[model samples]
Target: MRQDTLWVHREFRQLWAGQTVSQFGTYVGQTVLPLLAATSLGPRPSRWGS
Candidate 1:
């Protein structure tokens, strides 16, 4: 029982690590693209839709 639980725990940790990395990359892209758009075009007020 303990070994099975440990295996599941390890699997969750691996999934969490991969998700964290991907989320971080996505956030970086989210920020950079807006900056690039404004810089090339002009300083424009921004609004985010929910």
Candidate 2:
């Protein structure tokens, strides 16, 4: 079978599912961290340097 056809395999499906979940978590963390930092520290540039 060709490499493109390998997605039908069970292992590939599971790997794809896990990778999807992990990527989603990473995206959520990426979005949330900046918001958390903004809220917790306020929107001042001076506070960031020190």
Query: Can you write out model 2's per-residue Cα lDDT over 1-50, one digit (the tens) per residue?
Result: 56679676989889999999999999889998888898998866674585
Of candidate 1, the 10-residue stretch with the lowest lDDT total is: 1-10
TM-score of 2: 0.53
TM-score winner among the candidates?
Answer: 2
lDDT for model 1 comes to: 0.82
Query: Candidate 2, which segments miss by more than 4 Å at Cα?
Result: 1-4, 36-50
TM-score of each candidate structure, all chains considered together: 0.48, 0.53
